[model samples]
Target: MRNQVVSRDEWLKARVALLEEEKELTRRSDAVALRRQELPWVRIDKAYRFDTDEGAASLGDLFRGRSQLIVYHFMFGPDFTAGCPSCSAIADGFNGFAIHLAHHDVMLWAVSRAPLAKLEAYKRRMGWTFPWASSFGSDFNADFSASITEKQQREGGFEYNYRPAAPLTSRAAAGPVAEYAATTGADAATYMRERPGMSAFALEDGAVYHTYSSYSRGLDGLWGMYQWLDRAPKGRNEQGLWWRRHDEYERA
Candidate 1:
């Protein structure tokens, strides 16, 4: 729907009123970030390993000599022939910021269940320079609640975004789930097994600690396209899945 047309003076008045609410939201967002920083850390005891271009790496090694690490749990399962389009879009934004983050003592990486070769191929295709590591043949994805097993899917035993979810049924074989699954060349069940998330780790006192993690909509802030869309005249204005991998878009 079109906004009501108005004179400049009226528009300025309305915008000024909205500015107050926007300021309040900014303050609240700041407070929430502080709370996130204050969340207690869980010591990581398991020796999680990942396959990277550098070779096999322990979770601590992901920090790459930095004190902090942030890993995007990219939704590319071992069975997937392509990365999730949604994840590809999110990664597209981070690919540029990763170098800045690295310089600021934070190492940013994307971890997926796909094999290293698959990840390398996709990374080349996407032209992403950000570090990507494969959690294939490891429990890292499942332990972190990023990937689930078929048993978990059948038994309704999985939780995503920290909430218990119902077992995957035929219901997932339609709608956006099926649509996204097809894009990755997988069945809905296989696609849904791999979820999108981000996890933060801190290397302190010679040990790695899991400091924070966010999943599902909790990751909205990190999706750069959404941030731009939120400020657009039409806001998100989304209907169903309207995104694709950056390169997949047709030239104007």
Candidate 2:
């Protein structure tokens, strides 16, 4: 990128050095994953329900016959005409891999607060086959820290990513937040009500337990495109929110 040229021996020497650091990071990542799986789980007692294409379904029903479930808290509030473009970008990576995960006993679903009809229409528009369910008229999103009310945003009593997030007014309002809000056909206030996150659940003995939930930047690993970009020569050379839904890419 800097237009610098190096001898083959020098490049090979540098690459081998970097390989050792990469291997060390991989070992550290494996240990952290083990620790995550060892964390305590909480039994879910609330009878949360979701509206899916299959009709009304309970939390247990979301497992769809699998022992494990991973719910992607997509940002699509009740007022939005469409799903969030950024979230849609992430969902683009799901359709293919979700089937393989299902075969391995993990069920994945995208959960949003939007009505089932809206989610269904957008899913069709995006041509994503992965299951999606609506938490409309249910406390599922609120309970999972994926949706907040105007009162909470104004008065301050919510936590995301295991810590209290800064009040809504403090959020940088000029760039992606505003742009994506407009894309969803909702005002900034209404759009900000929905946040992105993912929750993991396990069913054992007919009871579902909350295994894990991640929010904010904690979801970096789940962005499959970013995972690939991080390994590219330029390495995710991002400047602001420069992504869109797959279909929305301009034709050259």
Candidate 3:
């Protein structure tokens, strides 16, 4: 058997080619980042409010004594009886990341328009202290298109709120229908009729800001990973499928 050896010139030429390609990629990334600075800033209209365990608060209050606030408008709307499983999966992650986010000028908290009691109860059930706030009795959630109002729904916004029946199966998608701005047993019917969430507002020098109400699927990049895995040849990601609700583990 004969072994094939490459010359040093061949190796260096290939390495330099790879280096130039990497440099081109870096240049493109830098150009894209410069555009981020030029993206237009929109001033929020209307007053957004939240009900915290401590009491009623505006968007600024969400800062939790910080300058920048990042609110995860979790899916569990006020009416639904339960929180979203996938979103809860997300909350599971944030339950750990919140500690680190607070270290910076950023305060990351989960926001749902659900009643304060309901939000608190769910937080306990999940064993998460990731700091959730309520937007019950407010239009903040609706304005941001998370939930809908009676007027909006009557005008045909019902499609925007949770529709449990929209799913092809009950067990799989029911959890999502109950998320924020979503209705429960009866609330889903009247979700658009009431203010539901987004209750109050704050005043700055001369403007009113919608205190950071949230939306799901984009808050975390978790949605992107799912989209990519769907195209993967493996069919399923075992690492992401271990959440067995404690029943499957015992059966096995």
Number of the predicted model whose TM-score against the real structure is largest: 1
**lDDT per residue, candidate 3, 153-185, as tens digits?**
444524333332131233433443323224233
Q: Model 3: runs farther than 4 Å from truth?
A: 1-37, 150-252
Please identify which of the two predictions, 1 or 3, would achieve the higher TM-score against the true structure: 1
Candidate 1: tens digits of C-alpha lDDT, residues 146-243: 99999989998778888898888797668998988998999899999998999999999889999999998998999998899999999999899988
Give a tens-digit lDDT track for model 2, residues 1-252.
654579999999989999999999999999999988998999999999899999999999999899999999999999999999879988988988999999999999999999999999999999999999999999999999999899888877898777886667846555778887998999888888898999999999999999999998988998888899988888898898888878777841
Order the numbered candidates by TM-score, best leading.
1, 2, 3
What's the lDDT of the predicted structure labeled candidate 2? 0.91
The lDDT per prediction is 0.93, 0.91, 0.57
TM-score of each: 0.97, 0.96, 0.59
Mind sharing the TM-score for model 1?
0.97
Clashes of each: 0, 0, 17
What's the candidate order when arranged by decreasing lDDT? 1, 2, 3
Worst 10 residues of 1 by lDDT: 243-252
> Candidate 3 — what's its lDDT?
0.57
Better-scoring candidate (lDDT), 1 or 2: 1
